[model samples]
Target: MNAIFGWSVLALVFLDELLAVAAFGVWGWDRDPRWLLVWLLPIAAMTVWFLLASPKAPYGGPVVRPLAKVVVFGLASLALWDAGHEGWAVALLVFSVVVNGLALLPSIRVLVEEG
Candidate 1:
């Protein structure tokens, strides 16, 4: 049961990351200079993910890692809201909180640390 929940949470984290990038894309779609923003925003978001959120990221450390997650997810949620996806924005925020909360549980954390 612990392993199952851990894996599920991990999968959800991946899904959240993808959804954040998509949310940025959605926002860029409606802005001026669509050609640039449509591609650029997601690229920037991915760069941040690679630098501060990935498992092997160098700059994350302890504080910066969680802070980066908050910044990325927060911006993504705001982007969704700004792009007329109010419900989706709220849902994404709520989903992130719940998923991260679950992942931090001792049982799941143990599985992750061991694996």
Candidate 2:
């Protein structure tokens, strides 16, 4: 049961990250082809690590690290949106980042047995 929930949460995290990357690629970066590869590399690396590490539940150092990645991606996305003069894109990206972060926080609490 815990394993299933953990995996589900992990999948959500991965999906959120992918959406962020894609958002950055499309709206934020002005659909730059080169930027797509650059944006995907860290996600690919994280996917590999997640598969190999095989956590029973989403806790510990690794879970926290992904949040940082999300923040970085969000900031980069904001910067790109600003560069492109897209105000709506910036708001949407920021909202996504906040929502993803909030979703992950509950899982962290569960993992830590704090709630």
Candidate 3:
């Protein structure tokens, strides 16, 4: 049970990360400099995730890592909302929170922490 739950949470985490990046892309699509931003925003988000939020991030300490995750997710959610994707924004926020919360559970923490 623990193994299944752990893996499930991890999957959700991955999905959330992708969704965040996609949200930025979606928002950028509706912007003035569509061509530039469409490519730039997702790339920027990916860079930030790799540097600060990824499990294997070099600068991701106990505090900074989680903080960076929150900020990134928050920005993504807001970007969606501002882009007239209010439903998607709320869904991403709620789903991200739930998955992150589940990842912190004692039983599943080990699996996620290993990332």
Candidate 4:
């Protein structure tokens, strides 16, 4: 279970990064230079924050922190998607939710186990 959780978290991280890159690329092609920076800053900040906060690798610990971060990022993506109304933004929002949902699975499992 720990191994699965670890790999799933890794996958979510990978997907999140990939989507971010894709969003930047699309923004560049669309000639919206500002969005490239906009998309990167938050992700970079979150990556740093996550690394610092989970220094001991807290995947198997309580789920609240991870869930909170996921919710925040998911909402941010959704807001961007809604604001742009572009296909790429929509795709990014969907990808964010799915990846975050996968990341949340371990927490959900923990909740079930506790009950």
In terms of lDDT, model 1 sits at 0.89
Model 2 over residues 1-115: C-alpha lDDT tens digits? 3645655555665665555555544443444565675566446545543544223334425765565565555654664575574675576566656655654565553653542
Using TM-score as the yardstick, the better of models 2 and 3 is 3
Relative to the unseen true structure, what is the C-alpha lDDT of residue 69 in candidate 1, on a scale of 0 to 100? Answer: 90
In candidate 2, which residue pairs clash?
none
TM per candidate comes to 0.92, 0.41, 0.94, 0.42
Query: Per-residue alpha-carbon lDDT of model 3 for 1-115, expressed as tens digits?
Result: 5698789888989999999999999999999799999889999999999999887898888898899999999999999999998999999999999998887788887776665
RMSD of 3: 1.2
Candidate 4: misplaced stretches above 4 Å?
1-9, 21-44, 51-85, 107-115
Considering every candidate listed, which one attains the maximal lDDT? Answer: 3
9-112: candidate 1 lDDT, tens digit per residue: 98898898999999999999999999999989999999999999776687876788788999999999999999999999999999988887787788877776
Question: Mind sharing the TM-score for model 4?
Answer: 0.42
Give residue 57's error in model 2 in angstroms. 11
Evaluate residue 59 in candidate 3 and report its C-alpha lDDT on the 0 to 100 scale: 84
Whole-model lDDT per candidate: 0.89, 0.53, 0.90, 0.54
**How high a TM-score does candidate 1 get?**
0.92
Clashes of each: 0, 0, 0, 0
Judge candidate 4 at residue 64 and give its lDDT.
Answer: 55
